[model samples]
Target: MKRSSDRTIKWLILLTPTVTIGLWEYTRHAFLLPYLSMELGNFLAPFIVLAVTLTLVLGLFRRLEQSQRALRRQQAATASLEERESLARELHDGIAQSLFLLAVKLDQLDRTAQDEAVKELSGQLRETVREVHDDVRQAIANLQQPPSPASDAWVVPLRELLGDTAGVLEAKAEFRWTIPESRLTGKEKVELHACLREALINVRKHARASRVYVVGESEEGGGFRCSVEDDGVGFDGDPMKAKERFGLKMIRDRAAKIGWTFSAERRGELTVVELRKAGADA
Candidate 1:
């Protein structure tokens, strides 16, 4: 809307002088020549044309300026809303879920007094800590993904990406996306694509896995997350080899720049690389 209005105003400004002079000449020859001498009419033409053109140009330019200001305000408001949504997704998907799981584990501890039960509770506690740690790492890796508008229709582009990157690995590749295209901004989409591409590249070069799966989902009225899962040698079972690789470090760095969470993990039997986006950004 703003662009269209500015263009219209510009055209009107250019045409103003031409139209005003034409009208003045028509009046002089067809009606006013009888009252005004030819010399006087000719002399007044430039000044009259200048006055009319100036008035119209000033008015049209003012309207253009006003429209531009309104468009800027609208864009600012949209960006702020996105920031808040991103923050909300972080809290809801990461910290909140972790805390709730901890609470459940504590409740189980309270009900059992046996030493064996106590030991089991200790294991559960340890597992929960590991889960949180894994979540953090994955969050860092996911944020680096480039995003499109939050729309489900973005599946084709992602599918093409998977085919171009993961397909050549001679593995059976599967892809799914449920997140709406309206959920992410254009910049987010770009960053996310970069991260996913890197993750897939890493899988092809190192994972030595047979199956690769990519999935994206938006929570019910909440945040969105996408993960790349593979049957490669899982990272959790092998501690010495689990240190962050350079590719993952690059991914984490990219994620940090945009405030999203991206992570790659190898569990007991599966390797997963995920990117998570909150509902908005702060």
Candidate 2:
């Protein structure tokens, strides 16, 4: 509607001078010719036309400015809401995942409580608690930090997560990032990081891989593709049997939720999990 109004305003601006001139000419020749002399009317016509034309043009331009300002405010509000959602996802991936891992460790300790040495169990429990505390502190710090515009703002934390996962699995991990242009939106970045984190965790828990390789690259047409490849024994049964594995289901659900393509397959000696956004390859 604003665009249509802008077009109409432009046309009106163009016609303002013409309409004013025509009205002045009509009044001077037909209505006021007897009352006012032709010489005086001719002298006054240009000034009258200029005044009316300025008034109409200025008023239309002011309205256009007001419309543009309103549009800008709306866009800013949308962006702010998206940023908040991104922050929420970040918190989920960070603090929530840490708590889940802590729970798993505690469950493991409980199961082995009858068999394991008391000293060893106590040590593991303390370490797990410390790790959880650190994660919570880091998450709070991240929440308080101002938003960053840097393209690689997500890189550092993702690398750290992969490294930590590799340590847990006692496997070698390597990451290659070839994102020449980081044009990902806030939601896309959050989903991408979460997907990669889930992939590494899956590898750590299930894949008996000695080495893992993660790659993020620009795709051909215009989009991005990230793959987690491991030289591990791949899934033996149907990969899509979601009921059997909760982690795979979570990863797939997140990708689907965010409108990204996700696939996991065994390619010879390597199992690969890939995520791709539709138009971010460039």
> What TM-score does prediction 2 earn?
0.45
Q: Kindly provide the TM-score of model 1 when superposed on the true structure, using C-alpha atoms.
A: 0.41
Regions more than 4 Å wrong, model 2:
1-151, 242-244, 280-282
Q: Could you give candidate 2's per-residue lDDT for residues 41-109 as a string of tens digits?
A: 889988997788678778888877877866775677568657866776777777767776776777767
True lDDT of residue 237, candidate 2? 80
Model 2 clash pairs are 222-281, 223-280, 223-281, 223-282, 224-280, 224-281
User: How many times do residue backbones clash in model 2?
Assistant: 6
Which prediction has the highest lDDT against the true structure?
Answer: 2
Error of 1 at 38 (Å): 78
lDDT of 1 at 191: 82
Provide the clash count, candidate 1: 46
